[model samples]
Target: MEILNSKEMIYSPTENREEKLSITGRVTFLSMVAGSVLALTNFISNSALAEDVIKIGTPLALTGGLADEGKKQQIAYDMWLRRVNAAGGINVGGKKMKVKLVAYDYQTDGKRAGQLTEKLITSDKVHFLAAPFGSGHTKITAGVAERHGVPIVASTASSLSVYNQGFKNIFGTLAPNTGMTEAMMKFFKKKLPGTQKVAVLGRDDVFPRAMAKSLSKGARNRGFDVVYDELYAVGTLDHASSLSKIKSEKPDWIYLTGYTQDLILLRKQMSDLGVTAPIVTMVTGPAYKEFVDGLGKLADGVTSSSWWHHATDYKSDDVFGSTKAFYTQFVKEQGHDPDYVHASAAAALIVLQKGIEKAGTLNRAKVRDAIASLDIVTFFGPIKFSPNGMNQVRDLPIIQVQKGKVSVLHPADIKNAEMQKM
Candidate 1:
């Protein structure tokens, strides 16, 4: 009699009756073999399904001028990833799916950022995308995401120019640049009635240029004379020429808009040149701890605005609990306090997750629509996108560095302290 095995067939003598199987026994054995095969097939199918995960592609400036901010953005996303995975991943269409982030270092080059974004969508086949840091990089990458019909939540871009391009797939966490300076201008008008003359200086970049122009217009509208408004070239180390002109103008208020390192240098140059303005407001640097760490006492009385703050008491029904809780968790994970940049980055991720959960499907169009219609408040603050796909629910909080700490100066309702004179 011959018995069939997986690899070969073997012939056995009838004398070995104990080892040889009877006809009925052979049929039973075959039934067990068939059942084992079916079980193995099912196990493989289930394993494949269980391995399914949502991948989010991100391009960050991990080794260039924007490295500090880009690293902060990564940290923010990492925090969200830990929390979501710990809670058994995101519930999508009644199935729990883990998330995987595919990130690349674009080295702060806008063109490289755009190329990486396209590669992420086409090659990596990511389900969603996160915008790169800064307006220039975000704008470049956003165009790629828009062309592919992929929704991207921009974390650090506040330039209105980026959102004005009619890209329906793009959404921003920060308010427009114009909105950032509105509260500060109104506060100056009501609080410092005598402040009139103003000088605006910004880096020759998309965001800083737009921010300076917006601040100049806002100041002029608020009854302040625009003394001197100029833009210095990017990477301009010596601002003596500009500072000399600004000093001659003797402006009552000076608004400086630039990146963190640029602003830090500009502040030091202002001190070196003995250029003094009674009211000094920087667009973004002063709100970050690096600025204070870079200038120490020099950072005092320097006012800036931000999209979110850790001191906020806003409540949320999201994963981070409340504003205070978010801050607490961020400190625990990162070993330091989070700034507006971190909050904005984290909020962008939160907004994306909320949209996915609401849509209950991975359909791109449905998730995009869900994000467009979002009106919920999170730990970052109220988040609602306008028809232009820019966040409209949260107002920028004006903050001034006082005694080595950030103090909210405007929107009296949430203000932690009054602005002190420089």
Candidate 2:
């Protein structure tokens, strides 16, 4: 997918003596200052005039393991930008200003993400910032934004540990990692009464490890015995040894958490080792279409959890009117159904815009306060940020792949299907 460059450059009046400005641009600039000379001077000196445009800096992973996720996030950002621009931009302090994004491809490196975040804040001079793809990358980049006192909205970082750091400027869209297993455990206890043994496995990373720990606690709290729990090092692709050990315990439920590629490889190895569990739950991968495309029938009955889905009856005043509307437009544009990742990415930008509008000024502190106090419902879900800057309004939805289609299985209000045995 081609990334759209949403940044618009404003040229000085001295550059073109006879050129005419667009009606929208001229009107937007005139509303900023009283006289033409002062407007021209402000335009020449500060390219990102507060009256003209709201610039958001974003660092994306355009290469390496997270490249696919980065592309989907970029697409969501672009979609929001186009919709805001089409509506004559965001309304701020009684003036309309266009939105622009200053984005860079970080190549999926944490060090590069830190460097680019500094450059985006100090050199590019963006008003707000968007976090990188994953939890580890977001933690590194968010530190830079916090030090600079720039507000950053995180799209995908869901680990509780990420927000536990003392940073007032960072905010997240998704719920905490514990929500993933909390919902599944409640559903499993009711649906499958005899399921008591569970084996938990995860990658030795910030997000995956945190999720595994939460799952273990939630399982044990609900009277399920944890037969085996272990964490493998990152980049340890061969999981035959772990599968062999897990097979010996004969666990009724097997839960795995990791990145998309890691989960894909683990599922394949489980089949190769002839290790079968009545219930298998994987974090994040089964919610994405690529998981089904890669595993075919193997993805069937494999359950997962998500922060948002199109089956909800939620509505928003943003570009996408409702959950159904957003899903329709995303599928129309991308040629596939969007997962929670895409919805969360768009919701992050929407929350930022709402904060700026509520504050009615570009001041960082006021905007940050507005975000901290936000209590609005969005197409993605109800997005109310806790005092810790993590979303606490939405609950994770339990989903399973039935007949090669993603089916919502829990939360009786929006569930489209029931839990099925693997």
Clash statistics: count for each candidate: 0, 0
Model 2 scores a C-alpha lDDT of: 0.85
Residues 1-422 of candidate 2: C-alpha lDDT, one tens digit per residue? 12222232233332233233334667546533333565467566665465588889888998877899898899999988988899998889888889988787888888988988888788667899999888899999999999999999999999877898989999999888787788788888889889999999989999889888999988888889999999999989699999999999999999998887888899999999998899999987787888878888888989998887778878778788899888998989989888888999999999999999999988899999999999988899888898889999456789999989999987889999989999
TM-score of 2: 0.89
Candidate number achieving the greatest TM-score relative to the actual structure: 2
Off by over 4 Å in 2: 1-50
* Model 1 agreement with the true structure over 1-422: per-residue lDDT tens digits: 11122122111222133234335877557655654555566456645753577778898888777888888898888888888888887778787788777787888788888888888798667789999888888889999999999999999888888899999999998888788788778887777888889999998999889999989888878778999999999879888899899999998898999888898988999999998887898878877888899988888889998877777788997778899999988888778889987898889989998898888888889999999999988999989999999998445788999998889876777889977777
- The deviation in Å at residue 228 for candidate 2 is 0.6
The 0-to-1 C-alpha lDDT of every candidate, in the order given, reads: 0.83, 0.85
Q: Model 1 off-target regions past 4 Å?
A: 1-51
Q: Return the clash pairs for model 2, or none.
A: none
RMSD of 2: 7.0
TM values, all candidates: 0.87, 0.89
